[model samples]
Target: MEMTKKIAIIGAGPGGLAAGMLLSQLGYEVNIYEKNDRIGGRTALHKMGKYSFDIGPSALTMTHVLTSLFMDCKRDILDYVSLLPINPIHTLYFQEVTFPLYSDYAATKAVIKTYFPGEEEGFDRFMKENTKKMLYISPLNQFNYSSLFDFFRPTTLRAIPSLTLGRSLMDDLARYFNSKYLRLAFSLQMRYLGMSPWDIPAAYSIVPFSEFYYGTFHPIGGQNKIVEAMQQVVTENKGKFFFNSEVTDFELEGNEIKGARLASGQVIEADYYFTNLDFMYSLGNKPNNHLEKKEYSSSAFMLYLGLSIVLPLSHQSIVFPDNYREFSDNTIHKKILSKDLAIHITNPSATDNTMAPINHSSIRIMVSVPNNTSAIDWDKETKEFRQLILDTVKERLDFPDLDDYIEEEYIITPKDWEEKYHVKYGAVFGLQHLTRQHGFLHPSKKLPKYKNLFVIGAGALSGSSLPFIIENAQITTRKFLQKENPSNQ
Candidate 1:
């Protein structure tokens, strides 16, 4: 009889759930310790009265990555979550003009040609080149790179040409077309990762390409259903869960972790340990490893509106500010709280009836503000900022009398994420994808000091997007599995 390998995971985030499902299927006795009474971490649902909203990641992209997770467990994708395609994937409200980006390639190309006229050729060329680029590097993001030497391995070497050197993601788009609106539609994907489009590496052009190529999807109930589904997979395979159990610290001897100490003073012993906690919150705290040198991703100011009526709009929309260059610069770099803010609105109820009351809207707004480090006072300014966003949405989009229709409202600022979510400085996107901070430069999935330790979530291997974070779990779990087998013979 063989002994079952016992593994303990510290968070119940999508990354943690992903790891638990995979490891349990591989026959590991797993226990996940989540601080909250509920699962899903940021992926969890937010409810105010009868209104339900997705607190994080309002848009679902790269859905094939999620389908692959269920397939790995030999389960039907539809068995866990039902997905509905969003036709006009996103309608861009760029100042005065309205652009509807369709899911169909021919339709989107037609829209681009209609608006910008001469730029359809550029869109066609981009679709051709970027499709090849994504094909080359998509496989590379799924592996762990322990060092620069590891980066030069076969997969990374093969992806070198697609790496997009000597320019930012914004500059790369400029090479394709002259329309800033078109450039913006493509570039918005990477910025949501808390990086400025002009600052992040050009390789992330894959964000929009993947979304347009694969099309966008919404779970029948909510994105949170995916979290619930993963939990089912974990327990069915014999994995255990401990909710509301906060990990206070770890018991370590030199480079190896022996056990994890909970807040109640009970320590859980395991053969191998993995934490789904945020990169900074897990480490550097009294109970976890912490590095002072690591910089964090930017935070957000979010509003979830439970309205009496739905707006006449697409499923998703972005309302760009008039001065986007200055807005992007100040929001990220100069650390100014601009009254002119770029707002993203997602009306989940428009597509999924379960998210809100009959015909009522569940609106999620994300305004990319600074992390908590700024001198500006959030406590005093939250009201004004909220009003500014609401005013802009109502006035600019001509959604008349929006103030009259609000039935309930919920808001989360950077301070809430820092204090409640316990992320490092409330970084919404985890680590910033700067030239000095991305790729092999970010934290490794396997910590250098601890032999039986691993990590997952926003800050790991791939960037923090849901699909990419799941890929991080796949990579981390594969390493442990390979180590267990050692050789096929």
Candidate 2:
């Protein structure tokens, strides 16, 4: 009798967990090792005195990506987690006016009309064009391509009229509407990928379509509930999860990954290994020359606040300064926190009461800052920076004595994230989603020197979104299984 193959997955983030679950479902014996005590790398929730906040990825878009994962397992995602649609997905606050982006096209258009009355036709045209762009790029997202050149082939060329990476997202919108407020509202979605609209490829315009078309969703309990659901699937498939087990080194035999050595001085061997840890970090303490040559993504500074009083703001809000470009430049070049920055405020308790104490609220304020490696004095700077942000939020939103409402607060500077998550440079997203580093040019599952080793998550193809990471995991597992067992195919 042929023995069942064993697979070891490193990291318990969504990608690693999803990969382990799928492989186990395919009848392989899988073991998942997570360095952290909990699952969900960046998606984990941090609890304070009376508030629970989603430490990473505050919003959920592209529900179909998640649903497809459940469908593949011959189950429904809804059975695992309840998803609630959030209409007017988020409110964009600018110096001039505030606009709500609704799931319904008509409703969003009407909101736009309220501010720019005569520009309804323009808004409609822009949406139509944006939708066309999404339809064109959708195929690339769902399937694997051989190379960057392949995207310019005849079939892809046919869609070129709809695809536009030649211009920035801001420039594309500038062609449609002259209002800075409207422009800011639409372009703020670029920040979802930690990019600036002024430099981000227009091809990314599809981001808004994903949210508007599929609608933004929130898990009923907390973001961590999704992690629990993924874990359940893995457990149901007979996969073993080893939390708080840090992988210290890879046991290689003749350029093939034989197993891994844990920080606890134990060894776990497997036929194949899948790593969801940050690509750079997974290369072991002393990396080979090639691994060291690769680049990394931008880091972030996040502040999780548990308010003593309920905040009157919406579930999601982006407070933009007059000079959004300066903020973007500061993040990209200076690696400094912008004085007039873009702030993403989320009060999950508004949508799910379990997040905070009765009549209280939970809020998180995120600002793109330099990676931890930068020479900024976070120890000395954190207090001053937090105060600046608080002052700015109070003035912009006109909250009455907002400082008094803080019952408990926790801040994750880039240094904290780097030390905790092993994310090189404290980058939340594994790699930058630039034109050169996107799609096919992104890292591949097949390791350069190791035959049985593979990579998954934001560092690999499909880029750094929850849905894409999950998708990449599924794709990598399927490919590996097919390669290892031709009879199964």
Candidate 3:
């Protein structure tokens, strides 16, 4: 009789949870070990009194990814979670004007004509060109490429033009928009990766394009609903979750992971090991201080505020600094916090009443800051920086008595990410998506020497965002099936 395969997953983040669902459905015995008592690492939920906030990922785009995952499992996603579409995806507040990005092509064009007349033509061209770019690149994003030879595949070869070699995101936007503010509006999506528009490659222009093409969504309760839904699927398939059971390190043989060692000194052996821990954190030791050489993405300082009054704001909003480029350079390159801040505020109460009590609001604020590599002392800086963000919001949004309404509050700085969450360098976005880190060049899902070990998370090939990470997990699962059941092929 053939023995059933057992897979051990470390960390119950989105990636691990998704992997558990996929693998369990494939008839594998799956066990997930998480350090925290709750699931959903960074994607976890936080509740204070009657208000709640999604700890990360304020909004959800790319609904099709979740739809496909559920379809593959022979289940309907709606049965587990409710998805509400967000119109006017997000509102952008400039110094002199407010602009809302809509999924409707005609509506977006009308807004462009109203705000900056001549730019309406540019919007049409931008959509047309970027649609082609997304078509060219989408196919290859689903592959699990571990080496440069993988790029030699016909699919990757066909994507070269869409890569837009040697062009930055700012340069690509400039090709269409003559207005600097308009360019800034489109490139605001760069914050999702913790990158500067002048630094990330033009191929990423597909990001903003995708937002307008496929409108964003909000899960009725919070972004964490996706996690809870996936967990339900995993549990229904007989997957087990071990909370507060941390996998401290892996016991290794010549070229395989023998077993995972937990913090309690327990050794759990399995047929395969999948870790969703932060990439660098999984390495156990940096080995010659190699970590000092790699470039990491910037970190975020987040504030979760539960207010006593309803906030008169859209579901999502971005308030740009007076000078975006300077602020980007300071926060991402110079490794310093800029007083001129670009803040993203999400008031989920606008669309989902479940987020807060009646007549109350739950607000989440995120500001980019230097990662843990910077010497800035978050202990000394968090108080003043928090006040600065609140003050800026009060002044810019004309909410004079904003402070008086804060009934409950929580903050996460780069320091808190490292000490509490164990994220390497407190880089919430993982590695920087530089030109050198694209496609085959990014960290491979499987290490060359580790025959039975794999990685799936923000640091892997698909990079950041909940959808990409979950998709990458699916790819990893398929690859695992092919390798272990070659005869079944």
Q: Who wins the lDDT comparison?
A: 3
Question: Each candidate's lDDT (Cα)?
Answer: 0.82, 0.78, 0.86
Between candidates 2 and 3, the lDDT winner: 3
Instruction: Report the lDDT tens digits of candidate 2 across residue range 1-489.
Output: 999989989888898988977888889999999888888888887888778988888778888888888888787998889887776688887887777788888898888788888777877778788777877776665455546677776667767777675888888888778887777777764456666678777777777767777788889878788888999998999999898898888876787877798899999999888986454354545554443444445567788888778887777888888788888777765677778867888888768888988988988898877665468888899999898888888889998666787788889888887786777677666556666655565555234547787778776664577888888888887778678879988
Q: Write the per-residue lDDT of candidate 1 for residues 1-489, one digit (tens) a residue.
A: 989989999889999999999999878899999999999989999889999988787767888888888889988778988898887888888776999998799999999988999999998888888999998888877656656787778887888888887688899999898998999888885346876788778888888888888888899878899999999999899899999999887887887888888889999999998876453254435443334455566688999988999788778888888887777778677877888878888888778899888979888888888877677678898999999998899888987877798898998998899899987777788767765665666655334457788877766654788998899899888888777787942
lDDT of predicted model 3: 0.86
Output the number of the TM-score-best candidate: 3
Considering TM-score, which of the candidate structures 1 and 2 is the better prediction for this target? 1
Q: What local lDDT score does residue 5 receive in model 2, on the 0 to 100 scale? A: 87
Q: By summed lDDT, which 10 consecutive residues of candidate 3 come out lowest?
A: 279-288
Clashes of 3: 0
RMSD of each: 2.0, 2.3, 1.5
Q: Model 2 segments beyond 4 Å from truth?
A: 142-155, 277-297, 443-447, 487-489
RMSD of 3: 1.5
Record all residue pairs in model 2 with backbone atoms less than 3 Å apart, i.e. clashing: 308-405
Provide TM-scores for the models. Answer: 0.96, 0.93, 0.97
- lDDT (10s digit) by residue, model 3, range 34-128: 99999999899999999999999987888899888988888899999999888788899989899887878888899999999999999999999
